[model samples]
Target chain A: MRIWHGLLIALGLGVAGGLYITAPAPLDAGFASDHTADTEAGALVFAAAGCASCHTAPDGASEGPQVLAGGHAFASDFGTFYAPNISPDPASGIGAWDLPTFARAVTKGVSPDGAHYYPAFPYASYQNMTDADVADLFAYMQTLPASAQPNQPHDVGFPFNIRRGLGLWKVAFMPDGYVTPAPDDPVLARGRYLAEGLAHCAECHTPRNAVGALLTDQWMAGAPNPSGKGRVPNITPAALDWSESDLIEYFTSGFTPDYDSAGGEMVEVIENLSQLPEADRAALAAYVAALPPIPSP
Target chain B: MKRIFGLSLATCALAAAAFAGSHANPALEGAVKARNAQMSVIAYHTGLLGGMAKGDVPYDAATAVAAAENLASAAAMKRAVLWIEGTEQGAVAGSRAKAEIWSDAAGFEEKAVALEAASSAMITAAGTDLDALRAAMADVGGSCGACHKAYRGPKN
Candidate 1:
């Protein structure tokens, strides 16, 4: 009985120690600290990342610059995660956060309060962003019109609602560096960075496991839409045989080889892609063309 | 009595769908045929413009002007015969139209008006220069997406 008590105490200590190590830690400022903000270049990052796709208020002003007021609901197997107000509003948005806080949240999934953000934010992919790009993006986002729209509380339930538990999830699932190998070709390398990091094509295109970690083995093979309505089409070289030019054209105009126009959420995706330079679209196509083909599931 | 009335109305719809499928009812199918023709005309002109926009075909002023004018004419076509009660996605074979076209008539008309507006703008832009044509193509694509996202269903 004394031995059993000793064993139980040891087990408890180990569990506590484990939790301590996995606690959310904000990233070191590193290169981001010395970098100067270039708001102009940040616009390129904003368009490539489709920051407006999930951040912009669907009902907000649409004509000129879109208001990134952030009430968009992202429904998932875990729960519906409403986007927080990211506008430059001092009170309601990220206006109070400095470049370091924004960088930590964007790249490390750690909040300003040092709490773990739910992976729904896609920092898993964003974690690969260059320090320069993060600084630039932060500078650009600060210039957008601010809205007083309050952030919506997420509808996550039960175990998922325990935000602290996500600390362990992150320790286990957070990948190191780019998921795909760095390529020698400069164009393919740019394509890989844009596709895997800023664009987060994997968030939708790559299937996830039961716990919502991306199935890296089946990269870009596509998956069931989180909405449960339809399948997101596979774009792996195995399934998508579109020429690089064809892919670029589709990105530019939303027209398929079949002459059918894009639909659903992809309409906005194409719109965002259309805003990019033609070279960027060409790079994305080149990156996709280089992916190891995974047969569609 | 309400259930009986609903059942008979459903039966009447099924009959219309059968004709829509087989083209036996010329009156109803004629409307479908006319709608399909207009869409084909739109597609043809769009392809012509797309080729020039992509530089697959050299951008000639006359061809660009003609294509844009044809697109505007097609967009402004009177189609009182199209979009009757029965020919929707699940109701008729090969029909990708959604029930929203009838359920929200004003929204449908708004999309048609938007298409006309877009094509009209395309006319002025198309013959100006390649850059202008490229700029116009984006809006035309957006207008197509706007309606399809609301009123079109997936392929069979």
Candidate 2:
């Protein structure tokens, strides 16, 4: 009877230990307090991040960027995940969320309720963002019109549906900072921030392991789109045989050198990119043009 | 008058036979080849104009105007017979046109009308100024996309 009692206590202790280990830690209070919100910079960050591409309703009838009512269904191997409403509606959106909660959600993939987020949110790439950018994005999002739309529940099944399991996946894949070292040049460094931090281009462009973690070693060599429709073309310097000017023009006009217009998911990305200043586009082109050429996979 | 009428009828019969034979096989194949060739020419002219717009090549007014004229003429050409019913997708190996084009005939015609309007506007704007050309570029690209999104397959 004593041995049975000891076993029960041990099992309870093990469960408690597991919960403690998986719990999400919010960002440092000092970081949130010190950061100031800038709406203008945030707007640029918002465009760079392509927030509307996923956050907007997938009905194909939603017009303009103002409505982020969020019912876009991202069907993946795990299951279909719907983007949650991030509009300023107090009851249905993130209006009640303080900057720290927003920051933690964007960067750490943690919810205000201390639950883990599915990586479909791309927080792994967003984790590289500076605290200032995240704050600015939060501020900018607040300026958009609010909607009263309720959040749609995701359709994940079985063990994959268990959100707690994602905490382990996060530990294995999420990096604490930039995936690669920042370049010495200020321009290239800013390009890295835009590309890796907010734009998260590598999320779509890089191939992934069987479990869907990005294969960082072959970064930006291109991969089959996660949505399983078509192959995303290789954009690494090795495979992209275009002049720097051609690259800039493609971003500005969506026309390839061969006269093929940008199609599929790229059309939306180019639309967002078109909103950016010419200088920002040029910076991106310069940075991509300078990447070490990787052979197409 | 009887001999003349008989000769005229014989000539009509021979012409109809030739037309039927062509429409049955080789002419249909010729149409697939001709339409593909015509599309290539359109792409070539557009590429030149696009190159100038991007400043990849020097924007010579003469070259720009010429390329724009070619594109406009190509877009306005009467090539309906080239896209006849039997030449889509599985009927021909290289044709990337989807079968929906036949079912959505009205939508396809609307897209063609849009391309014509855009191409006409492009001709008027092409050599006027860089700004005009840029504005026309968007319309031209948009019109192309409107059709391609619905009718064309992914490039291999």
Model 2 residue A193 CA deviation (Å) reads 1.6
Which segments of model 1 are wrong by more than 4 Å?
A29-31, B1-33, B84-87, B102-107
- When superposed on Cα atoms, how far off is each prediction in RMSD? 4.8, 6.6
How close is chain A of candidate 2 to the true chain A, as a TM-score? 0.91
- Fraction of native Cα contacts kept in each candidate? 0.45, 0.30
Considering just the first chain, candidate 1 attains a TM-score of: 0.96
- What is the per-residue lDDT of model 2 for residues A84-195, given as tens digits with 9 covering 90 to 100? 9888888889999988889899998999898999988989889988888888999999999898989999998888787887877777776667776779988788778877
State each candidate's chain A TM-score.
0.96, 0.91
- Stretches off by above 4 angstroms in model 2 are A1-17, A28-40, A62-66, B1-35, B76-91, B99-121, B131-139, B142-147
In order, candidate lDDTs are 0.84, 0.79
TM-score, structure 1 vs. true: 0.88
Per-model TM-score, in order, reads 0.88, 0.82
Clashes of each: 0, 0
Clash pairs, model 1 backbone: none
The candidate 1 chain A region of ten consecutive residues with least summed lDDT is: A24-33
Alpha carbon lDDT at B80, candidate 1: 44
